[model samples]
Target chain A: EKWASTAPRIASTRLALHHFDTSYSLRLGALWPSVRAGLLCEQKYGALLNNFAAADHVPQELEPLNAADFVSEASQKAQQWQRGAAVGAVARGCQEGSGEGRTVMQAEMMAQAEMMAQAEMSPPLGASISSKIKCYTFPRGDITRFRPARPDSLGLLDYYLMDAASLLPVLALNVQPGDFVLDLCAAPGGKTLALLQTGFCGHLAANDISISRTKRLYQILHSYVPREVRDTVSVTSYDGRDWDQVKGGTFHKGAGAGSVLLQVLVDVPCTTDRHSATEEDNNIFHKRRTKERQMLPMLQLQLLMAGILAAKPGAEVVYSTCSLSPLQNECVVERALDIAEAQFNISIHVEDLSHFRTLFQETFSFFSDCRLGELVLPHLTANFGPMYFCKLRRM
Target chain B: RALLPARALPAGPGPCPRRGCGEAAALRAAGFSQEQARRLLALQPRLGPEQREAAAAQLLLLGLSAEAALALLERSPALLRLPTERLRERAEELRRLGLDGGRLERAVRRSPQLLHVPRKRLRAAVRLLRERCLFTAEQLREVLGTCPAVLQEEPRTLHHQFQYAYFRMGVQQKEMVKARLFQTPFAELRNRHIFLERRGLYETPHKGQTQISNPKLKDILQLPEEDFLASLAYSTPEEYEVFKKLLAREEEEKEEEDVDALYT
Candidate 1:
């Protein structure tokens, strides 16, 4: 019931902000036309709504449709393809049944269809991002819990288990094998689960301050992960800002005095927008959002600072929030970066997010002015996120 | 030739004795799909036609629509086999807990597990909240309406939750009730309060005097742990955990002293 991120609510909030006469508001206003244009364009691609099988794992039934069948299907699809590629050969084929160089025509039609699908799936992010890190653009399971039940167990287990947007923060942390990772606000811990799935960590400390929610985190990990792997994980009930005070001094045990946390995930709480909320939600979310608007940034700044304090020199810390509010998202990141650098010598790495920004731009609406982090708007980018994230390193 | 036909495959070993019969039809009539009816029967195959009929009748008797009853059964098939007398008693008990009529229906709709909790356990939880926690019957009703899971919690857990809020935090019954203190686990509340108190950020409310520095019980408990630590406590998660352990030890020592006094 606590669905925080929804595309419609985010769109409304962003659009509502455009009315203000400030420079930021004007810039947001200017961006609205382009965003709307992009959303309108992506909606025509149709594949945005279609649930696709992974590139590697096409269904057995779907496999029988040869290149030729797909080409013909592509032609049929191309006729419906709104703009750009609706020219010459494709148009001719639509108007007239058979034409010269039919085989070549099929190939061209197939290529055009593929491009259109790619356009719908992955919008071009600008030149700021690099291509090194793997980025998945598909907004899998963002709206509903319905993941494709894959034939393979591993495929089924991992597929769409989390919002694709959430995976970026985990990646931003740059967790290495044997790295001591702490997910500070890890409740119903999708990111912790992803971290455990991705690397052979020495230990993962997953803590949620809420004992009830932590119990849920435990149940999620216990059900999905094997006991041996789950045993390697330490589930603790503690406030995330006290990142330095994990019990038994286990973080300091491995190396000399310099031993500290390698990567920390600081996904702070924020006011969320789920498009599918009811009238009751309006009252609850409005009151909650107002309180959060006042209270969250201070908490976020503190947690980010604590994250910096807990990390080793050159340790990576990823700051993230599932909110579109500039105050909670970009402003908090900016302030945290400033305070950490001033107090703890933690270097705010803009370059760290370039690759992420690139993937973000390619995948969603990428705003450049969110100085410290990448902003992912809901309808402007893909249908999944109003998520924001930034990465920093301890100097 | 490649894929096996439906009938070609051998029957699954865990076959139910009754299939496509009265219970399945009854469930189907009550708006379950064929597959769903099959799944329901398969989950609790021990449920006889009479038991299923009686359960449905009891659910109807309790004012749940056929659809609601079917949905509830499909979600929690274990409810089908619970003794009718016990089920009736529990339903009446919940009604008495101020979740009467539509509220009772909705609460069950929200969490069907509320139907399966043992009677003695439910009564004990109610008693703890009313007598020990000093919650008025109306406040107890509000707690039940808001969080029915309170009834499912162990009586000791409820007692601990109330004790921590009332004795340790000096939160009065009215404030605690309004805050829905029973919704959060006792350990979490203890950790947050202890962290704040240790930081000199929060004060324990005294009876006659105004609590100038004391944060409201609602504000204190409403925050997620990180927010409480960062905004209110101005403490770290590590320090909070360490403090929690220290506080636990302190409570143990106090309990030991009380035991010694009782013995003497």
Candidate 2:
């Protein structure tokens, strides 16, 4: 008596299994040559069994197959059957029955029974089974797996998922432990994460105006940070311009004194045309251009002023953005520097991002003074999204 | 230590005949030769007036090296002689200590035993040795002789070393904190919760509003409020159908409520 079941209709599962087989052979080839050497391995044997079963009748000559072939074929088929059966069992195993099968017509009673049986065996869990399978089945990727022990874990994840553009320059600036760091316009927290990663803070404070966005930022930090490091950071929801106003004095004079040396990262919002690939259902240029035009210059200027106001004497401020617009990049920086010249002695030292010089020249021709800061065009370094940055030191 | 040429010596008590002879000229004018004037300018004013005169007399008498005379002058506090060689030797000693000895000596004398230990090491040692019984060098040596290396390697010491290195490297506590926070099986579930919570939509019952009782409805619309609003703003016509249905249902309910109120 032969019993059999059809394969489940899960594209991800099929793909994962295929990937697993290929990777296993490639990896295990050196360790066990015999396993990789033979073409008719256990997997192939299972395929052979399925093919034989599909035939109407087995010929007399082929009916009694060799013992080795029969054993290999039987064992392989059983293994595949067991794994698929396990997943299906779990999906149907839920107390509430699985949803209707993908292809079952209203009149097809037989298909319904089959789907009912499968659902009964395998119950759907809210969490993706693929994630669990990835964690346990593959030992290689499991090395970095860790469980959150405290509330601050989410905070740490916000820091880790930061883009390379914001992270690299912070590393370049080389913040020391117990140094003061100010992040202006640090809402949904990419630069905030970068700053926290430095661990070089007597005090680190992040500010953003949007309450909803700040809440999201808090969630990110809560998810990502361990309890130990989470204690170091403080998030405040406030307008960047009003930071000094709220303090009732300059940050340098009030909060920062003595051993507190300032390092400020001003990552302001710009028209994010660069996220065109990731954002579906929108004309990237047309949708963002108007807002980019109106706000980039204004926000950039305000953020730069905030950074300067917050910085200690002889402190360095790194101003950055994700837009390629010269109006936002050079014009705002130049204007701010000009305004700051008389009141406070300031010097501007631009990072020579010679690596992406050609891309900047090609994409943004208006800003001839690449001397202000580094510009990373997405087309040049495919690894990073498009970004613009400049560094200013207070004299 | 080469002998001075006789002709280079001043015929009478006067400054060196060199053109840049401001201080050298003043010393020579005070009854010293050109060589003696140059030597006098370099010496400290610590020596006794008589000792300075005697040293000057000794320079004329013995013809010894300036270093030897300065060393002899340094040993005699009563000798009102400038210890130029002693000051030079002290400066060299400070350079070896990677400090300015003159400045350090002043600072040390002000607050003696001021050990300029490395900040990272000091922190590590403080954390390690905190609340432990004070052990002198003799006690530590005795302990080391008795205890095994394995026994010496305490968990506290290991923790302190790890923390110190991390602190010194400026490793952000945020990363560790985040690792503790989010990298878990439940983290993704929590993320979804946070997303929904931010939008003012939650799983629990509310007083006035109709609860989202259907599981499918809950899953499909589990986004934060801002995201939900944003989606509504730019939703496709097909997505708007559901909202339209809800709106129509609400209108019908209102009409039914009015009818029921009239009947009552």
Residue runs of model 1 more than 4 Å from their true location after superposition: A1-27, A32-160, A246-249, A254-261, A275-284, A345-350, A360-362, B1-264
lDDT of 1 by residue, A343-394 (tens): 7666766434543443344344556677667766544224445568887776
In order of appearance, the predictions have TM-scores of 0.41, 0.34
Docking class of 1: incorrect
For every candidate, how close is chain A to the native chain A in TM-score? 0.63, 0.53
Indicate the TM-score of model 2.
Answer: 0.34
Please write out the lDDT profile of model 2 over residues A1-395, one tens digit for every residue.
23223322333322322332344335333221111111111111010111101222222223343112222222233344345445555544662553566234324434334434433343331110111000001011011112222222222221132333444345334466677787777888755655664455666777788888889878766655456666766778778877767742655663545866778888787755334222333323333344554665887788788787777667778787765556677778888887677565555444443322321132221223464676553321112334677777776
Candidate 2 Cα misplacement greater than 4 A, ranges:
A1-159, A248-250, A253-256, A276-292, A343-369, B1-264
Indicate the residue-level lDDT of A135 in model 1.
23
Per-residue lDDT tens digits for candidate 1, residues B1-115, read: 4655655534531333445466777877766666555555655555676787677678877778766877888788888888888889989988977899887888898888998
> Which candidate tops DockQ?
1
